[model samples]
Target chain A: MLAIFKREMRAYFTSPVGYMFCAIFYAVSGFLFMLNTVQAGESANYASYFSILLFLFIVIIPLLTMKLVSEERKMKTDQLIMTAPVTLFDIVMGKYLAALTMFGSAFLSSSILYYIPLAIYGKPNAGLYIGCVIGVFLVGSAFISIGIFISSLTENQFISAFGTIGAIIFLLFVSALNSFINNEAIRNFLNGLSITTRYTYFSNGILRYDSLLYFISLSAVFLFFTVRVFERRRWSKS
Target chain B: MIKVEHLTKQYGDRYAVNDISFEVKKGEIVGFLGPNGAGKSTTMNILTGYLSSTSGKAMVDGLDILEHPLAVKKKVGFLPETPPLYLEMTVKEYLNFIYDLKKCTLNRKEHILEVCKVVKIEDTMNRMIKNLSKGYRQRVGIAGAIIGNPEVIIFDEPTNGLDPKQIIDIRNLIRELGKERTIILSTHILSEVKAVCDRILIINEGKIVADELTENIEGALRGNRRLAIRIEGPSSSVLSSIKKIAGVIYADISVEHEDGSATFIVESKNNVDLRKPIFYMLAKNSWPILSLEFTGANLEDIFISVVDEADAEATVGKK
Candidate 1:
């Protein structure tokens, strides 16, 4: 597992994809930060940053996760990883961790925007700031898992990226559809299923166990599915 | 040592490999000869635990591949047909990654150097794989496969893309590797099988058509009655005279030269050696014998005949 993780992480920096992902992420988030807070003359608050952060994730998550497993299959390097003295869990986890690490790098760099306001205005809500960071991390982790699972289904990077973006978009906007529903039970169930709703608790500095469990379990379930995809392929090829 | 029994792999309604069985004893270099899509790679993949057999078993060094994949994988080094490599990485980095993946306890730096030395890729160790030539990339792939000094090495088309010189170099390396490890090489190149393999297993359409020692495979194709004779005589007369012999099934002037001397390839009945009778006939006819040699069937002929017979049987079955 460690070996695969190390190789995958190195692969990111060696190719242009990793740098392109970070640059695009940083550029878009920086532009959003300047336009929303600086140019509009609004106070830099957790609420404003969280809103833009969610948008950032909707686009950036697919880029980070696009080539995770799909490129391995494309290059036929999956044969090496699959035939190694490692389990399918190890290969999936190693790739997931590598994608998460790349996302973390970009996520951490974007956090520099939080400090710009702290240096200028009165002290912002430290608790809210911390909450937003953790919230975005969890959201990104879950999105990365989804991307990994999608990537496992195909060898084309474009297809994997589009599939991930489509899925994330559906999950992100699922909360908005609740207004049209008259039945309270179905609305509540749909609201619970929404990623936006789950992230709302973290954005507001409320550490709800249900929300955390939801995100953690969401990531775990997708990762488990990814492993099963690989295992099933191994069995079918046999 | 590797033992496979009744191995079968089916895809949907089709059997990619159907009820095949073979064994490779320790220190044996076995050649798997088959045409494209003959299930050679599929069988090697199954034995290396890259794929699972639908039925039957593959045991490597006494461990069942399905039941204990890691244990079996640890003992086997596999170079798939495409030489699975991460092009973004340098040769050294790729090998080091493989060493770690194989969980080798040997001195990492020293072991890597030794492998590069063996595969003759030491000069390209620091170069990115994407920039290296196909032959060099293949060497790196082989290097990674052999990093842990696995007890068994399975190479699928190891010499597919190399030039003649590199092919010979790789063949020699495979022979050297066979001294300490059981090697199974799959290729359509019959000469390679004759050069490097101790035993040859000819597969046609997912079944083992012929399995025998390399020398015996050549001998089995000879069947004791085919001879190549060089004579200083008229082609028509010599052929006509040879065909009159009781044991001669047929005699044809295979090679005709501008000088009137010709070579005749003669086929005799089963269990008959026609050399003495041919010599006596030539002498009685006042013809001078330049040379007489037995030209037995090589691996190429045996492979073609075996595949042809299989195709004939399939045609008969379909009819």
Candidate 2:
């Protein structure tokens, strides 16, 4: 599993995908920080900053994970992994952790740079900022798992990326539109299904352990699905 | 070292591998001969634990593949039809990944170097796999397969894209590997089987049509003895006299010369020798015998006839 993780991490750098993801992320987040907080003359506006970043994630997370499993299938390298002594769980987890590590490092370093200006210009609430950062990281982790799962379903990278983006968009918008529904029961059910609804607990400077557990559990569900996809292929391949 | 019993893999309604059973002892190299979609790859996939069979079981070293997949996979090294390689990594990096994935307990650095030397890919260790030639990439694949030094190795079309020189080199390498490991190689190239394999298994439409020692393949196909003769005599009378022999079943004239000479291929019942009687009768008839040679089916002939026979049986069964 360590071997797979190391190779996958190196692969992200050897190809242009890693650098492209980092560039897009930092550039967009830096712009959002300057426009929404610095130009507005409001200090410690981490909530709005994180919310916009969550929207940006719908596109960027897919970029990070589009080629993870899809490229392996396309290149037929899955044969080596499947025939090896390792279990399917090991393979899925190794790839998932590598993508998670990449996203976390990029998000952490850029957010740190953004924080320096907030510190100099005005007072920033340390607790709220930290909570929001962790929230966004958890959300990003969940999104990456979803992208990895979608990638396992197809061999084409573009299809995987688009499919993941579609799924994320649906999840993000459903929560925002939940209040417009007339029926209370239907609205509450959609609220429960919405990933952004759980994320709101962190952006509001409220650390809900249930929400944290929710994100972690979501990630496990998707990774498990990815492993099952591979397992089904073994029986169905003609 | 490997045994399969009544293994069947069904793709929807059709059986891709239909009730196939075979065994391979240690230190033996078996060649799987088949055209495309003949379940050669499917059977290899099951043995390597890359796919599951609908029913029946495959065992490697007394461990069933389905029940003990990881253990069975650890014992067998498989090179699929295409060498499963990551193009972004260098040759050394890819093999190192395989080493760790296999969970090898041997000294890593030394084992890798020994495998590279065995496959003759030591020079390209630092070069990325994307930059290497197809032949070199194949060598890297072979290097990966032989990394853990598993007791059983399965190769699917090991020499598909190689040049003539590379093909001969790989054949020699497989022969060398066969000295210690039980090997199964699948290819449609008959000469490759003739050169490297000890036994041959011919598969047709997902069924094993012929399975025997490579040396006996031709003899097994030719159930009756055949003799080809050229005679300098009247074509009609010579053929009739040759057919008149007690043991001869059929004699077909193949070629007729302008000078009343003819060539005939004679089939004798069982393995009996009809040469002495034909010689004596020809001498009595004043027909001079130009040439007489005993002949049996070659590998190509055996392959075609066996597959054709299977097709004929299937059609008759359909009726």
Candidate 3:
């Protein structure tokens, strides 16, 4: 598993994908920070910055996860890994961790931008700032997990990326769909299923156990589903 | 060692492999001869635990593939129909990845060097795989397969895309590997089997139609010759009389000309010439023989006949 992780990381850097991802991520976050808070003179309001970045997650998460397994299938390299002694769980987790580390790097760099502002200007609430950062990380993790699962479902990376983007968009759209529902219970259920709704709790500086659990469990569910997709494929045709 | 018992795989209602069984003793090189879609890849996939059998068992080194997949996988190496290569990595990097993927306990640097030397890819180690030609890529695939030096190695059409020289090189490499490893190689190329395999398993439509020693196949196919004759006689009587000849294995009147002379194709067993006996038999029956000729049954002939016979039986059963 560690070997897979290390190799996947190397694959990212050797190709243009990792640099492209970092450039797009940092550029967008910098632009957003400049427009939303810096120009608006809204000090200590990093929550809005992450909230805007969360929307950009739909486009960038696929960059991290689109070729996770799909490229292996396309290149037929999955045979080398599958026939090896490692289990499916290890392979999937190794890939997922690698993508997460890529996302983490961008997240850390953006956080450094936040630190610069805090050092030079008015002090931001450390708890709220940290909470928003964690919230954004959790949101990205869940989305990355979904992206990996989507990649496992198809061999074509184009379709995988679009499919992942569509899935994340639909999940995020679910919360805003609350008013259209007539039944209160159904509306509440859809709202609870909304990933963005769970992230809101962390961004508001409230450490809700349910929200943290929701993000972790959501990531787990998708990773489990990815593993199942691979495992089931061994016994049956795609 | 490898053993497969009634191993079957069905896709929906179609049997990709049906009730097929074979075994390979340690250090033996076995060739799986079959045409396309004859379940050669399916059987190899099942044996390697990449695909599960629907209603049978495949055991590698005595461990069942399903029950002990990791253990079994660790003991076997498989090169699928397409070489499973990561084109982005260099040859050395790819081999190192395989080493880690296979969790080889050997010293990584020495092991990669040794495998590269074995496949004769030592000079191309630092070159990216994408830059290498198809032949080099294939050798890299083989290098990956032998990384752990597993007990049993299965290769599915290992030389499918290679040029003539590369094919012979791979055949020689397989032959070299067969000295200590149990190797099961599947190919439709009959000459390849003739060139490398110690034993041969001819599969047709998911069934093992012929399983014999490679030497025996060569002797049986090369020695026995098919004879064609044009004789003036009652077709049934002449065929029956020709079949009764001691060395005649099969006889059939293939065509009757307008002149009333029938063309018969007779197969002799074990290289025995049936021309003299058939001529005497026809003479005793007062039939005039106009032409007699012989054709040796090459490996292509054996492969065709075996697969055709299987198809014929399958069609007959359906009817």
Candidate 4:
């Protein structure tokens, strides 16, 4: 697992995809940070910061994960990895962790904006900032797992990327689609399904275990699907 | 040692690898000979734990592949039809990654360097795989497969795209590697099997049609006896006189040239040596014999006959 992780991490940097992901992430986040806090002349509230962060996650999660398994399949390198002494869980987790690490690095870099506000205004609530960071990381991890699952389903990286983006966009707006529902039961169900609702608890400094579990479970479900995709391919004749 | 039992792989309604079974003993180099889509790659994939069989099981050493894939995979090295390589990585990086993935605890630097020396890719270790030529990339792929020093090595079309010189070099390397590891090579190149394999398994249409020692298989394909004779005489006289010999099956004039000389290829009855009879008859007829050479069946002939027979049977079955 460590070997696959190291190799995948290096491949990210060696190819232009890794640098492009980092640059786009930083560029968009930096612009959002400046526009939301500096230009607006409002006190730095992590609420706006996190709202923009969610937008960044929706776009960039696919970019970071689109090629994880899809590229391996396209290049036929999955044969080497799948045939090796490693298990399917190791492969899925290794790739997921590598992409998460890359995403985390970019996310952490953008956290520099939090400090800029700290210098200008009185110190914001430290606990809330930490919770928001954790929230973004967990949400991003869930998205990355989704990307991994999508990547495993096809050999075309473009399809994987766009598929993941479409799914995430749908999830992001699922709550809005439920607005017209007059039935309380349907509204509650749709609200629970919204990732933004789960993330809302973190942005407000409330660390709810239920929300955490939702993200973790979501990630697990997708990873399990990824493993099944590989297992079926390995067993079934092409 | 590897044992495959009644293994089958079916794609929807078609059997890519129909009910097939074979065994490879310790320290033996076995060749899987078949034309394209003859289940050579599929069989290798199943053996290496890259794919699971639709029915039956594959056992490596003593453990079943489906039940204990990691254990089987740990002891086996597989090079698929296309060398699975990450083009962005240099040879050294790719190999190091494979070593780690294979969970090798050996001296990493020493082992990798030795493999590089063996495959003759030492100088290209620092170069990215994308920049290397096809042959060098192939060597890198081989180097990766053998990195863990596994007991069994499976190579699928290892020499597909190499030049003649590189083919010879890789063949020699395979021969050397076969000394210690149980190697399974799958290819349509018959001469390669004759050159490197101890036993040959000829598969066609997902069936194991022939499995025997290379020499024994070749001999069986050649049948009990056959001979070719070169004669300096009129073609009709040579044919009639040779046919008159007791043990000879009719003689067919194979070649006729401007000089009016003919070469006849003769198929004789079992346990018959018609050479002396032919010589005496030719001398009596005043048709001097120029040269004679006995021809034996080779791997190519055996492969063709087996596949052709299978195809004919399939056609007959369809009707």
Candidate 5:
């Protein structure tokens, strides 16, 4: 697993994919920071900025996870690793952790930009900052997991990326859809299923246990499915 | 070191491999000779545990491929039809990655250098696999297979797309590697097996039709079907009588004898051993035979005859 993780990390940096991912991450977040806080003299506490930037996770997360397994299949390199003395869990988790770490790099790079200002200005709300950071991280983890699971399903990188984008859009778009419901319980239930709505609790300085559980389990379910997809393929066909 | 028993792989309604079985003893080099889609790759995939058989089992070093895949994988190295190379990494990184991937316990730097030396890719260690030529990439692929010093090495057409020079180089490498470990390589080329393998297992339509030593295949083909018979009888009568025998496709007098005897060449249908039928037919007619011998053929003819015979039998079975 460590070997796969290290190799994945190298592939990202050596090719244009890793640099493109980080650059896009920084550029868009920088663009957001410029419009919302820098020109307005509001020292940005990036947690809230990140919560708003979370929608764009759909775009950048795929950049990191798109070729994670799909390219291996397309290039026929999967045969090497699959026939090696490693287990399927090692391959999946190693790649998943590498992608999650790429997301972490983007999060950290953006945080450094956002925190320098917060450190210079008046102190930001500690609870709100921590809560929203956790919220965005969980959301990013889930987005990456979804991206990777979709990647395991196809050999074409574009299909994997677009498929991930479509899946995430459905999950994030459900909250706005809840307002049309006449029944309050139905509205609340639909909101519970929506990923963006769960971020609201964390954005306002509250760490809801249910929302945390939701994202953690969501990521776990998809990661498990990714492993199953590979194992099932070995027994049968693609 | 390798044994496959009654292995059958079915996809939907077709059996990709049906009741296939073979074995390679320790320190022996075996070749699976077959045309395309004849299940050479499928059997290798099953032996490596990359694909599971629908039934039957494959064992390497006494460990079942299905039950103890990792253990079996550790003991076997496979080079698939296409070299599974990560083009992004330098050859050094790729070898190191394979080493780690296979969980090798050898000294990393020394082991890698030794493998590089063996495959003659030492100078290209710093180059990315994508930048290397096809031959260099193939060398790197072989380097990957022999890395970690596995007990068994399997290659699926290791020289499939190489030029003559590269093919000779790879053949020499496989021959060198065969001295220490058990090896199995599959190819459609007959001379390839004659050049490197100790035994040739000919597969046709997913079935083994012939298993002969490299030295014996030549002898086997000579004794196969074509016969040169010198008979003591009237020339026209001898030719007509030989033509009437079952399975004899062609017969003609080649040499006229002044003493009422002649040498005639006899050709038979695929897989038909006409020697016995001709012997009895001539004896029943009270014609003494002067001599009988097999007119030898090269390996190319032998391969075609085996596959053609297999096809003939399959169609006959369907009827």
Candidate 6:
């Protein structure tokens, strides 16, 4: 498992995917921090910055994961990996953790760098800032897992990327679609189901165990599905 | 070291590998010979644990593949038709990754260098795999497979798409590797097995149509020794002399050369070395022997007839 993890980490930087992810992340996050906080005369406004970054995660996080499994299948490298002494869990988890570390590193480093200016120019709320970072990282984890899972289903990278987009949008926008419904019970249910609704608890500097469990379990369920995809393929007629 | 029993793999309603059984003892070089879509790759995949057999068992080194998958995988090295390479990585990184992935206990740098030398890819170790030609890439793939020095190695079309020189090089490499390890390689080319294998299994339409030692394939069907020889002497005298030899079934001029030389197709009794007697007779007559060859006898015809027979049976079964 460690071997696969290290290879994937090296692959990210060996190719352009790693640098591209960090670049897009820094540029957009810096711009968001400037527009919503620096330009708006709000010195320590992390809530708006992180919220926008969460929205951006829908696009860029998939970039980090689009080729993870699909490229292996396309190049037929899966034969080498699958035939090795490693188990299927090791394969899926190695790729999953490598992608998590990439997204987390970029997200964490940028969060800290942007926080530095806030500390100098204005008194930043350290507790609130920490809460938002933690919340965003968990959300990014969920998105990355979804991307990896979709990547497992097909050999075409474009299909994996677009399928991730469609799945994430439906999960994130469940709350937005709730306003059209007249029943309060259905609205509450959508609120409970929305990934964004639970995230609001963390972004507001309130730690909710249920929300944390939701994100962790969500990631596990998708990763479980990815491993099952491989297992089922062994029995597949093709 | 490898055994497969009643292994059947069905793809949809069609059986890709249908109740095929075979065994390979230690240090034997077995060749899986068949045409395209003849279940060669499917059988190799099942043996290497890349795919599960629909309803059969494959064992390598006394361990059942499905029951002890990781153990079986550890003992068998596989090189599929296309070398599964990370084109983005330098050969060095790829080798290191495989070494670690296989949980190899050998000294890391030294073992990798040794594998490179074995496959004759020493120069391409530092270069990215994508930059290398197809031949070099294949060498690197082979190096990766043999890294841990597994007791058994299986290759599917190891020489496919290679030039003649590269084909001969890989064949020589396989022959060398076969000396110490049990090896199974699949190919559609007949001469390849004749050149490198000790035993041959000819599969067709998901079944073994013929299985024989490489040396016996000709005699196994024809029950005689056939030789095509070119002689510089007159055609009439050479034909008469060859027919006069002991155990000579028949001798006839197959081709008449413009320079008074002729080629004769000689059929002799089985277990007879007619070349020695033919050589002595020509030496006594002072006629020089130009060229003498087995001509593959009836191996090609045998392969065709066997596969055709299997196809006919399948057609009849369908009706």
Give the poorly placed runs of model 2, Cα more than 4 Å off.
Answer: A42-44, B230-247, B256-262, B273-296
Tens digits of per-residue lDDT, candidate 4, A1-238, equal 8888898899889998899898898888877777776676656465677777887777789988999999999999999999999999999999988998999888887785556666667666778878888898888989899999999999999999999999888778889978688999999998988988899899889999999999999999999999999999987756
Q: How well is each residue in A17-129 modelled by candidate 2, as lDDT tens digits?
A: 99999999888999998888977763437689899899998879999899999999999999999999999999999999999999999999988888898888778887888
List, for all models, the DockQ compared with the true complex: 0.66, 0.73, 0.62, 0.82, 0.57, 0.77
lDDT of each residue in B40-115, candidate 2, tens digit only: 9999999999999999989999999999999999999999999999999999999999999999999999999999
The DockQ-derived docking category for candidate 2 is: medium
Model 5 C-alpha RMSD to native = 5.6
Give a tens-digit lDDT track for model 3, residues B137-249.
Answer: 99999998999899999999999989999999999999999998999999999999999999999998889999999989856545467888999978888888888889777
Query: With candidate 2 superimposed using the best TM-score fit, by how many Å does residue A38's alpha carbon deviate from the native?
Result: 2.6
Share of native C-alpha contacts between chains A and B (below 8 angstroms) recovered by candidate 6: 0.86
Choose the strongest candidate by TM-score: 4
lDDT of each prediction vs. the true structure? 0.88, 0.91, 0.90, 0.89, 0.89, 0.91
* Residue lDDT tens for model 1, B1-319: 8999999988887788888999999999999999999989999989888888889999998899999999999999999999898888889999999999989999999999999999999998889999998989899989989999999999999999799999999999999999999999999999999999999998888889889999788766555467888899878988899999889887888888777789999988657879888899999998888888877566677789889998899899989
Lowest lDDT 10-residue stretch of candidate 2 chain B:
B294-303
TM-score of each: 0.93, 0.93, 0.89, 0.94, 0.87, 0.91
Worst 10 residues of 5 chain A by lDDT: A39-48
- Give residue B250's error in model 5 in angstroms: 10
Query: How many Å off is the CA of A85 in candidate 1?
Result: 0.4
Error of 3 at B259 (Å): 28
Clashes of 2: 0
Query: TM-score of chain A for each candidate?
Result: 0.93, 0.96, 0.96, 0.94, 0.91, 0.95
Better of 3 and 5 by TM-score: 3
lDDT: worst 10-residue window of model 1 chain A: A37-46
